[model samples]
Target: MADIEDEDEFDDLLELLMTNWRNVRQRKMPTSSGADNTAMVASTASTRKNGGAKDDRQLAEDAKVEFDMSSGDSENLPDEDEMEKKVPIPGGVDIDLNEQAAPTIRLNPKAKKVGAPRKSKTVTQAGDKSDRKWYQQAEQGRQQAGEVTLRALADALAREMPSLVDTQCRLSGVIVKFSSAESKKPKLRMLKNPVVTMDPFYLLPPKLLDACMKVLSVANTSECAIEVDGSQETRTVAKKDQVETVVIKDVGNYSRKQIENFVRIQNLKTVVQLGLELHKWLTIEGIPALPAKYHDVANQVAAQVLETYPYTQIDCLPALPDFTFSMLYRAIPPTWLSDASIRALCVRLTHDFPSCRFAGFQDAVPHKTRTRRSSAAPVSREIQDRVFQQVAEEGVECVLLPLNFHNTHWCCLVVVVSTQRIFYYDPLNQAVHLKAANAIAQHLKISGLQAYDVAAQNNPIQFDAFSCGIYVCWMFIRHVVRGPPLDMSANALPRRRFELFFYLLSGRLLTREEAEQHEAEAAEEDEKMPAPPAASNADEEEDVPLTQVAK
Candidate 1:
């Protein structure tokens, strides 16, 4: 209450103290604290307010002397704390008076004096100076912003291309499209926007893949196309006067195939070409060839086609083995070895592709601790565990189960992952292994596999009793190759067997080069061979070799 009149005085006192503090800071003077601070500020203000100009001169001289002593010639400043606290504040960045962020300004002990002339008086406010120097004021801000943008760009680029940093895989990359014939490397081709990339065998046209798959897709699923003809090169099956050409129908029914333009086609070569494309597509999509997933419907269509069209042998060469419809290579029927053959085929497929798993035909033997009431043979927990783990790890696309029901006959069950369907294939009899198939399905369901419905396949029929095993093995191969169609008669099996033998001997899938090589050979053969005897207007004019499909 007594200091009510002093309210204005107190406010003035605070203002003067603040002003005094600012002036001391500019000259780097030691700041006095507590009661002494208040007293010194009050006295200075009173002296200036009363003594006017003369007292201000004294204060100014004192500030000049202080600055000269601290920062002029001597390396050491007596008031070290004063130098640490009183840093040169950056000009004109907005600072909150209520919550000022105090900066820690370190004064180097052996500090070299900054190359700036000292001003006699302090200019506190931004507006006091006519020259604001906008560039200087925003220097720190600009640098900070630049760093942030650069960081962001670096992060984005890394995500898009981690290889950008590698010298081998520099971001400034080039692509070279060269032929197998080309010996010398061409000049580097700069990658343009929307980069065009292709496989190593890019020489083969992409359009051919669809055409080839279309023919193969049907041929593989159908067993009728799996045929052999050693003298197929010499034989002419059909003379179509309507098309004015001789069309060899090949071993199986290629009734629907349009082979009206080529020199010749070897059926095995076509199968090889088809197999090659299947592998390429599967590899591209990361789908397994044998016992795979996702590419089911397309595979099915291709497989079904195999049943309808026999693999036509058009481009048969003299050097290649005679693998036609002969008794020497006739399809052998399965006997006691049927079970072993089927199991062996599954094993072979599994070994070929890591994605495939073969569940064998052999039943688990009962354990010594088995109860009399338990009529079913006991399964080895260790074996079951291992199988489950393997299937899980391999992506569970397809499982081939070759069953010998009641030690009587052979049957195949293909478990497709994506479709969740078990293809129950028994060309001789579908009812042969119903109980066994059911039991297998139940076991799979119980053993943590996805539930699968048994779907009947129009299996290829066998002539001899032993052919069931052969059929089962062939089916296993088909599964690995995304399936070939079922053959109607057991006659085609011999041809199919011969093809399989060639594949095994070669130990590699046929490529575009192989097909192209055969084409060259066919062309040579056509050039050497004489023109066919021309018939009447109703008869054919020229030969139309199987050129309907390509890979």
Candidate 2:
């Protein structure tokens, strides 16, 4: 009995082990395919949320497997109640019971929350960044396209009309419709369709248009027109004519009249004063008088007294006033006269005129002779000295001596008369001293005395004597009269001389330096003085009294 019991226990133990093995295997296998059905339901829910159709649901149902289980026809026995108990649910649906549980699939706890996406957010952050970059690139491309369109329009205008190369045409008044069907491109319309339309082709040159555009860009506005009247060419021609005819009619005529009027006016008193002044110089400076033979004529002519007497007696013959004849005796070559005449005149006059001496020639000295005769008249040095000494002894401040010549049928004889010493010549004495020809020749530094054609010859001796006499006269006038020197030249006087003359004429003598200083002082005084009150007309009534004017 014990052996049988032990065997039965072993059998029982084997049965329990088999039951446990069956249970374990069942748990490892799929259950009733219901889990797949649950998976279909979950898939259907996902599809419905994603806007899928019922056809997809039907397809899911068609893919499902159907199985039936009867309680009476069962081949296997059911499990105990404790073994059939359900397990705790997980976060995700179970696909394989044998497989390890997925780490709490989580079901995206934050899904469909406030900021979460309603759909599956399977795209990566890098993909989203890429998408944004692409969108920005597209926007940039659109902007670039707009710029390219404008640039193309501008380029088309530039190519069609070269005159509009750098210039922009703005639509004034109204915008015009440019039909692409009509002309394949855009065009500028400065005016409406009318009888006359300016063709851009013939309007302006390409180079000029470029220049115009540059000017317009600087000015920032179109305020000027493209002058097509050929005015530029006309202006150029007009300018050429203006340059050629520079002198105006009135200006030319006035200049000529001014020159003529200047030459016509002469001062006679200045000439007489000049001669008297020369006589005074000769007397004060100890220059000798003229030679005895020619003394009377020299004095008479130079004193301007030749017109006083018609016929003057010289050595028992009658002598007439002859300027032409007198000039002949003084002829000398231009060059010889400049050097020799100055020296001879100064030497002779130093004796002839008691006070005057010959100053050097100021104007250009001539060098050409006009006479055939080389010999010239001379004056003696001894005679001139004796004459000067006599005048000095007479206590005469100044003396003019005259020399006269009488050409008779027999011979030519001369007489000397001193105007200053005319009172000294007594009619009772009745005796006249004469200068020898040799002495005269020696004093004059010439070989012989000969006649000269005054009209033909540039007589330097006479010219020198005239200039020296003028200079001496000017010096004497300046020194004795203490006044300005007179100008006898035909040309206009120097500015300084004119100013001096005007000052003397005005009876207000002031040097230029003094005048400037006085002007400055006067200006200062004017500034210091109070301004004068404004004068009112009687017709214009005054609103205030004179005492209340300042207030």
Candidate 3:
């Protein structure tokens, strides 16, 4: 009994091992869904039990048969159609893999392959299979349309014949109308104002424009049709006598911009009248209303300027609107001061200060004259004569020589004629203009004048590109008036420009006392006003009822 039990135990152990191996192999095999793998497992277990006395070769054969059954298609395996139905596609659409897919695009049914030319299928008559030639039909159509085929040509040509003739007639009429209209139209009036013709103040100066035209190689005169309203140009000068010379004092009531507009609108009869109005507006009102920072513009020199303006002489004034002080006063983006401005200012300065001779920009040196020239003769005798003529003739104390560097920068040389010393004042804080200095020294030598020392004066340094002109003007003022130096820092440049413009326009200068008094009054007024409540920012006034608001 013990021996029989051992044999049965060994058989059961062998069957269990075979069952586990079959399961592992079945999991790895690529079998179809619904395949009965259990059949192979059961068959292998039965063969092992039945063939307990079988040889090793027979056992190996049974294992091989089990593997083949699992590898090959099973009787319970699902059909292709059923498997296709069970499979899931990405977009939830059934795809047929059996049938060939139709092409997305098809070639045109009548298109011919690119090779030898073939006859066209177009028929000349209905239901006729004869090929029609395009060139032959086109030639026939053309010949029949002409006098060759009288009957067919008459029928086809009759319809479009009038349209062609009518079109030609209409085009002729349009051409005639255009020519007549051009002839009838009045000729465009050219610039006829005498002030424009004379080119006063160098506004649209014909000589300069013509020179530019010559440089540009433009030969036509009609290209330069600078339209100047004849009425406005003539009326301003014509009505000069009729306009009143009243000084507008009520300008203080308006804002600075409004006052500027008022000044622009005023059709003053003379420059003196304009000067008086500017004096009232800028000196008495405008500068006083500015912020405290700009108060420095009102200094002793400005006061002196106020006392000496609107001179008895009439030739001191500039004629063109562009060169006028009204235009120069605008310094939003400061521009280099024009030679005309410097010349006019010099003229006025000479008239005011008889002892100090002022040289015009042109008289000092020719336009764009470089000091780096190899020739020792810096300037021509004519220029030297013009420059030193006043100094020699009047025995002037000093000569104010304003120099324009490359038409971009401006600096001034204060030549003390008596002492023979030249003080250079450049806003850029650069080294003394050596070449200009050498030229001046040479001019003095040729003219038999005393040799002067060119020394650089300690002037305020300009931090910007366009403020050189303002600095030059300020230096000229300081040398002439002998006043304490005013602010010329980068921060103060704008106000300084305003001051210069006001000085030029009003013929008035600011005084320190006036500036201080106005500032004190403004401060006192500020002190008298009530400050806003601390809670004002947190809650708006409208949110809190007016009745509940703090007084």
Tens-digit lDDT track of model 3 for 1-551? 33546887888767656655654654434223223444444554556556645644444345546555442434444445665576332332333322234545423323457887644545425324322343344345444334322233333333443232222221121111112122221211122331111101101122322222233322235757656785755544554322112111221111222222222212211333334444445565556655775566554424533443222222346564345443342333434566655665665566667777776552233323434555546555665676667667655777777766667677777767777776766677654454454456546654665566656676677788777776777777777765467877766665666655655555555544455677899999999999987655645555645577688
Model 1, position 206, has a per-residue lDDT of 24
Worst 10 residues of 1 by lDDT: 254-263
Over the stretch 278-370, how does candidate 2's per-residue lDDT look in tens digits?
334333321232224434433443343222211121221113222211121222111111222223323333353455432232211111334
Identify the candidate with maximal TM-score: 3
| Model 1 bad stretches (over 4 Å) | 1-340, 364-383, 430-432, 483-488, 501-551
The per-prediction CA RMSD against the true structure, in angstroms, equals 31.0, 41.9, 34.5
| Best-to-worst TM-score order | 3, 1, 2
TM-score for every candidate vs. truth? Answer: 0.29, 0.14, 0.37
The sequence of per-residue lDDT tens digits that candidate 1 reaches over residues 114-217 is 78866555554443462344333333333432322222323333344222113112211211112232332122222222122211111222232233333432
Q: What does the lDDT read for residue 314 in candidate 2?
A: 20
| Rank list by lDDT | 3, 1, 2
lDDT value, residue 16 of candidate 2: 55
